[model samples]
Target: MDQTTTTTAKKVLCIEDEHFIGELYARALTKGGYEVKVVIDGSEGLKEARTNQYDIILLDLMVPNVTGMEILKQLRDPSQPALKAKIIITTNLEQKEETRTAIEQQADGYLIKAEVTPKQLVGILDTLN
Candidate 1:
């Protein structure tokens, strides 16, 4: 395979509250060749989600100022272009109800923080339609 082939990199936006997790995820996505941006709070995350174009979104369930559910709710509005992006939930919370909520909000996938690594997440993105 020619390493120089032109493959348009995908854009990814990660919404996370924890400092370490944000850096970890961003670094991983960057290494995976995606243009990745990290926002620490749901409000700021929501703002970025509204103002930008992304191929996918990684949303943490719990955050300050706003929760992931709130962000998902706002993004689901038909007027937002980002709503078309595949939304992936990343959270330590693995409750069935939370997963159901994420699904209802149109999430493409859900990842339990403790069970997933950056490499694995990138692999998931590779399998997307």
Candidate 2:
């Protein structure tokens, strides 16, 4: 008799407002064997983040309804259940001080959207573990 084994794909949630960017990441991640969910609205993304279980979260800073920073703040709050997933900030903004603050606030990693391609993002995720 022959038996087959299957491995579960890692889950990733991408919170991005730009439709093209979000789709690009989603397509790449899906191709890389990850189950990817893209949320275009920050508020909706935050709700999904709190409710769902994911291995990693790709968050964009300047999103509508709720900013990624606010979502990170809430996720890091001691009062909330510890967010078990790694949170990586994906943004085009290049403010040095803000980057420092995000790192200080417990962001697992940060990437500039303009500087990273989807394949590179996958490489980054691979190094996380």
Candidate that scores best on lDDT: 2
CA-lDDT, candidates in order = 0.85, 0.89
RMSD of every candidate to native, in Å, equals: 2.8, 1.5
Please give each candidate's TM-score: 0.86, 0.92
Segments in model 2 whose C-alpha atoms lie over 4 Å from true places: 1-3, 96-99
Instruction: Compose the digit string of candidate 1's lDDT tens values, residues 1-129.
Output: 767878889999999989999898889889988899989988999988888888899999898899887787788866755466889888887567865865665777888888988888888888886
Any residue pairs clashing in model 1, and if so which? none
How does residue 94 of candidate 2 score in lDDT?
Answer: 74
Q: How many backbone clashes does candidate 1 have?
A: 0
- Tens digit per residue, CA lDDT, model 2, 74-108: 87888988988999999888757965776666898
Q: Give residue 127's error in model 1 in angstroms.
A: 1.1
Candidate 1 at 44: error in angstroms?
A: 0.8
